[model samples]
Target: MVSKPSSAASARTVSVLALVAAVLVGAFLAPVVYDAAAPTPDRVAVISVDGTITSYTADQLEEDLHEARENESIKAVVLQVDSPGGSAAASEQMYLAVNRTAQEMPVVSSVEGTGASGAYYTMLPSESIYVTPSSVIGSVGVRGSAPIGGSSNEIRTGPDKASMTLDHREAQIETLKHAFVGSVMEHRGDELSLSREEVAYAKVYTGARATQNGYADDIGTLQTAIDRAASEAGLENYEVVEKEPSTRSGIILLSSQNGNSTVVVEESPIGYDGVRAPQFLMVYGQVQYEDEVIGNVSA
Candidate 1:
């Protein structure tokens, strides 16, 4: 027996066949499409540090460290440090953050070019420090600026303000310097036997010298540092999470005009010269000038 199909039925059959063909094609190309489109997960949060270590740098490190701690997938943190030095306060802040993060997760410091003074100080809190063979490290000291008196005549202040004399101020500055040196000694005494005098001197040293002096741990590249951190964190395959500056919680007010200014003026006396001609005749002359003129000229 032979059967003839209706036009509408034949059209429906063709549509079904086309749909099946499309489904097969999609299945065959699905892996290739996903492989090309999907982004590879990063395994480490790498922070690069260069130049002077400031509060901004410290804040950045702290933010990244906190992010790594919160992210379960983020295994380790690799701090790539290459800085000479900066403010002691800034370095201390960074050191505290790194230390706290190390307690929770593995944090490694890698010296790429140089890490001296404040730079080295920031690295001290890490679990283990890695430095390139040629990298410089280990100044490990503190420095600050003190207000030195210029001259008694030049120094002026409000009536209620206490005056600072040169000798007394110098003695106070010296005392502060001694106190700072003592603090450095306390922090680094166990790691390296550095006397207060040595720390106060603020000396620089090479990577090899740093390791020998117990300043740095190992001499290796940044990659080695990352690997070590990962190994210490016990993470074979993990994802890296970078915390952007904008995503930070606190508010940063960066405005130049936040205060007011006022000006004050004062008047003082001046000396005049008298000329005597021969023994019989004497001549004296006085010049009149406004206080504002004198103040403006002096200022």
Candidate 2:
């Protein structure tokens, strides 16, 4: 009958509709499942140093450097150093970390804004040093200071108090400076040929001058530094992993783990000429407050 033929046609149409619905559902989900199962691409580790060099910064760089060395897929490391300078000990630690890491992988130092004093020392061990045209690069020297109090000559029972003599303080500063000079000479003795006077004076130099004076290897931008690293490592195309965060607003407060205990005051509050006063003392490796008020608090 005509009804039978119409019923057969309707049944075929229902079957086709069901197939189309199933196909649509699969098409939507296939990509989602595939994406979830996909592997992440390997990336090179980028270390950025901005501001003064410190033990914390060195520790962070060491950690990342070790990670990159262990992961074979990581092609190279780019060190973006922008700093004025810092403690001699901190600079030495960072220099050692970079040298050790460079043995396993290509380490490139890219001087962006400023790399001076202790900051410049860190770049000596790198495979190649790159600097921007306008970047400030060299300040190849060392400095150390200790607080001297003019007002109080109170006799103390502890070894901590006994150790606070003028002679001892001067000796400590000299020792730190000597160590810094030694490190510089160990890495760049032939190139720099730095004398005692040069290291002691702490001279600042521009990027071009640094390159000319054998303080820097080449003058180039950040991208050029990256390209140089990649070329050295024989990487045709590698991903750049910028590990440093864009915003560093909160980083300033958290830089040094050690409390700001050493207070250096410029002018003598005790009306003493050519006398320095330490506001606080470090007793047995701990910060101890000094009650005696002395010089003008410049720091």
Candidate 3:
């Protein structure tokens, strides 16, 4: 019409219309109209192992582990530990419970302040262990008052019946150490980089040194431990739930199905003076000498 627009101009006009059409079509069908799918969240159960590991502490741990086991939401467990060790039997019970939990799902032992001796022993059952740089570890040994000599006032039936002789006591301790060492070796297996003698000496290793010596898998933070647990459990988005003891009752009360019940009360800051018999305790601390008076003032 104005010389009927040139063929080149006509082609350009059609190209512009086609471009606009494509843009308009794309806008109508854009994915931005829909929100992204929500990620499935998993649950991680954290149980504390603070202070000394007593029989009561072991009971709580068992209950916590059992609860976690029963909960379908819990994908893994993290033992947040800070203990200088405690009763050997209690530690063993906790270890057995942890081992059972591991068989079901991933379990991680994360050390905070100090996870030594019996506390460290409890770690053997975990799939992996993590500790902060300054955390204490090891002291793979036991210490308790060895019934020094038989009572002169008390009459006994046999030579060893009155009390465990010094020799037998020493031998018993060695037996206990052997068993402890065996458990450590069995659990750590080829991952153990330290020599048998090093382990036998019951030396504590720092986090970095522990990893180097294979006493620990890595030096990491609590979050790192949780993340490791999550990875082991194959979880992306996850929830962390801490299971604090529901009751602070310092009493052990039990009742049978037939209604026979019993309750044992304890003194706060409980004394470990062998009230439950001389304990084969896997504890670490300055040992009290016979000559020194306990709970003495510095002044």
lDDT of 2 by residue, 1-299 (tens): 45455888999999999999999999999999999997655455678876655455667777777878888778788888887766566677777888888888888889978887677777777777887667786655544334346526667777565646667666766676676667667666667745656755666667887777666788898888888888888878578888762332112111121433333322334543343322221011122223322223222
* TM-score ranking of the models: 3, 2, 1
Question: What C-alpha lDDT does candidate 1 achieve relative to the native structure?
Answer: 0.60
Clashing pairs in 2: 149-277, 267-296, 269-294, 269-295
**Which candidate number maximizes TM-score?**
3
Tally clashing residue pairs in candidate 1: 1
Model 1: CA > 4 A from native: 1-42, 150-201, 238-299
Q: Candidate 3, which ten residues in sequence have the lowest lDDT sum?
A: 253-262
**What lDDT does model 2 reach?**
0.65
The local distance difference test score of each candidate is 0.60, 0.65, 0.77
lDDT ranking from best candidate downward: 3, 2, 1
lDDT tens readout by residue for model 3, 1-299:
36688999999999999999999988876755443454445799888987667788899999999999999889999999998877778888988899899999999989978889989988898888999889888888876555545677778787756656667767877887887888899899688987776798988878777887888898887788888889999999899999875445433221112221122233335653212345667766642222322132110
What is the lDDT, from 0 to 100, of the residue 114 in candidate 3?
Answer: 88
**Local error of candidate 3 at residue 79 (angstroms):** 0.7
